[model samples]
Every structure is written in structure tokens, then in C-alpha cells.
Target: MTGDAEPASDERTPGRRRLARTVLTGAAALGAGLVSGPGPAPTATGSAGAASSDATRRRPAGPDTALRELAEGNRRWRTLHERHPDETSTVRRALLGGQHPFAVVLGCVDSRVPPELVFDQGLGDLLTVRSAGEVLDEAVLGSIAYGVLELDIPLVVVLGHQSCGAVSAAVHADLTGTELPAHMQYLVDRIRPAIDPKLRGDARVDAAITANVLLVRALLAAEPELAARIAAGRLAVVGARYELGTQWVHRIG
Candidate 1:
């Protein structure tokens, strides 16, 4: 019995040693940036499992993967399955070292359409920029450029939402020829070109909303900094719309 036990113990010792070596090798790889760490893990909750599924998924390395992450997040949000991942103290502290956000979301400043909530992404997952009616200014453009040029974020999503007050206001001003207040007029002026004078009512407003998104996307894509990345296929620019009623976000451009 002792002789049989000795052989079994010897066999197990080598297996354990091999397992330890493998673990150490993997750890070294992670430390060296040769392997990416898993995304944030979520706390336990009924709806968290689905949201947290993304946390376990690999980090998005390019535009396509980043867009897919956003789509999945939006689905979880619309389905009432938001995981709200990566808001933990640990995740926050870890981010102090640096942020590695994969995408830039440029959306409306409307309180109801916060890009983070609409996409169901937590902190450090997205670099978000907002303006009324999704209008772009020099500052806003610079911010987006920083995300792409400095941060090397791969995807830029120009997000427009339904019933956007800014767009509606712009459309109303266009139809009536009533000038909005100075600053507000700036927003209107930016959005005015996209409005179709022939269309009226909700249809006009809706078309303007989508057109604004496309316009912003085009401007970003044409920027010298962003254009190079697009030409190299290292980046993508997309336009999407968020429905207030359904909480659904669909690409329009």
C-alpha cells in the first residue's frame, strides 16, 4: 500500500508543478501587455448576469468590436437587462492608472439621452462628448480629435435621439424664420442646413435628427486626423439614432 501511494504522490507533484508554471507564464503575459485582461466583472443581480457577460468578454481591439460592444449594451438596456458593469471601487481605482476606452460617443446634450446610459456602458468604457442637437463646435471637434488621435480610440458613434428638443427647436426656427436666442441660435444654425424645408411636422423633425447625425459623422470622418485613421482602416465613423419610446438605438449612417 505504501509503495502504491508513493507513485501516485510523485505523479501528482509534477502535475501541480506544471500547472503552477502555466499560471505564472500567463501572469507574466498579462503584465507584459501580451495578453489583455478580462473586462470588468459585475456584482450579482438578476439582470446583471447578461450585462456582466460583456465584462467577461475580451476588450475590443478595433472599431468593429467596439461597435458590437455598444450594440450589445444597447440591447441589454432596451431589454431592461443592464449590467451596469465596472462602476465598482476597484474598477475606479484601477482606472486611475489610465483609461483604455475603445470608443468615442458623440451624442445630444439632452438630459434623457446620456450616451453612457443609452449604451448601458459603465465608466472607462466610452469617451463621450455631447452637444445640443449633436452640433459640433471647435471645442467639441478638438475633444473628439483628442480621443481619436491621442487616445487612439477606434470607433466614433454620432448618436441622435428621437424627440430631441434641440432639433425640434431648430426645425421650428427654420420653418418660422424666428431667430432663437444668440447661443441657442448657434445650435439652430448648425442644425438648420440639415432640415428639409419641404417636410413639416414630426416627419421634418425626424429627418433633421437623422440628417444631423449623418452630417456630424461626415465632418468627423473628413477631419485630417480622423481621415488618416479611416484611410488606414484603423477607425470607423457611424451614425445612430435612439428612440425615446422604445429605448432602441439603430444605425442610420
Candidate 2:
């Protein structure tokens, strides 16, 4: 269903309309932006799989490969054939000393969208950073830089999802002209620009969520160190969203 059904006559009241609009728009809204080409993933230097010399012992072969692997994993997850790879005792032991994750996943703090589970990644496969609505600051950017500059992670996936509470709250607050709690106000304020003020209800929230993903994608891609890596064909930064009902994830930007 498109979830665009008109409300009852009485439900068209301002408060009722606001409530209706606050509901999240699902995968129907596809966020848009530029998606950079993938780059080669750096070699794993740790002792775990380094000694075996098996390609599977390490992360995916390259940035493009990493993205492809995630897409395949999502297919498995949605199909109920999740490989759930690389969680064995030996794999855990190998990761004890250090981690050489293939990708850095920046996702919302929403429980349903855990990067590893949604992408079907194994232990040490992803460096995940989550904030309400995926908002970023100096610290978050610093962490991402560490993943790129230090760990040499080849892919950065900004994962948003359907019905984000944070985005919904921001949309509702914006439309109602109500300020949230201090810290929450900060988050809603950051999310405002991504949404159009003229839009109301679910359309507003859906648009904001997509905008948030693309905005974050551009922000990370423009980071000085990350920009260098992208220019050198050593990184790929992408924006994607997870469909709650379908268990599928697709790139939006």
C-alpha cells in the first residue's frame, strides 16, 4: 500500500492531521544524490586470516566488492538464507589483536537498522557509528576519519531507514513550531534543512529522512582526508535506506 489514504472528515482536524503526517513514509521515498565509484580495499595486515592467504579470510577485495557483498548479504537476509559469515571462534580469535573492517557504516541509533545484521556482516566487518537521525559533529567525523585515515576502510555506507523516530519528531516539531528538549532541539534543528517547510505529515518526514541521508553522504565525501581517498580511487561513500517490512536495503544517493 502507498499509505496515502485520506483521513476521515473529523480526522482532518489540525491535531489529527499532524498526527497522521507524523507517521513515517516507508521505502516509497527514495533519497537522491551523487554516488561515487568504489575503490580498492587495503590489504588486511592482521595475523588472523593473513596467514591463511584465503581471500575470504580478510574483508571484501575492494570498495566495489564490498558494496556488492553487502547487496548480496541483504538479499540473503531478506530471502532467509543469511550466511551470517565470519563469526566462528577462529574468526573471533583472529580479530582479537586488531580490526580491518571493509566498510564504515554510519546509521541511525534505531535498533531495527543495525548495520551488521542488516548488511549481514560478521564480527569486525564494519565500523558502525550511530546517532539519533545520524546527525554528526566533530567527534563523529573524527571517528569516521579514524576508520578511513587509520583503518583504511574502503567503503562508507550511510544507512537510513523507514519511519525514523528522530526524523519524524523533527518534522512534527517543524510543522507545529514547537521546540523540543535542549539536546533534542539540536537534533531537530540539524534535520530541518533536509525537509521542505511547505510539506506536511508523512510526506514531510519521508522527504526529511532521504535528505538527511544524502546530506550526510555529501558531508563525509567532502571531508579532507576522505576526499583525498575518493580522488585516489581508494574509497566509496554511499547513501542507502533499509525497508523495515521487506528487509531489503537500497542505495538512495
Q: lDDT of each model, Cα atoms only?
A: 0.71, 0.70
TM-score of each: 0.79, 0.78
Q: What digit string (tens of lDDT, one per residue) describes model 2 on residues 1-253?
A: 1122221222111111121132222211222321222223233334444434333554675677777678666655665555566776667787889988988899999988888888767788889999999898887898889998899988888888878999999888888899998789989888887777766677778777877887777777777778777777788788777768666576765
Instruction: Report the CA-based lDDT of candidate 2 relative to the real structure.
Output: 0.70
| TM-score of model 2 (CA atoms) | 0.78
lDDT of 1 by residue, 42-152 (tens): 333554454445445466898767776787677667666677867765667778999888989998888999888887788798999999988999999999989988999
Model 1 root mean square deviation, Cα atoms? 18.6
| TM-score of candidate 1 to 2 decimals | 0.79
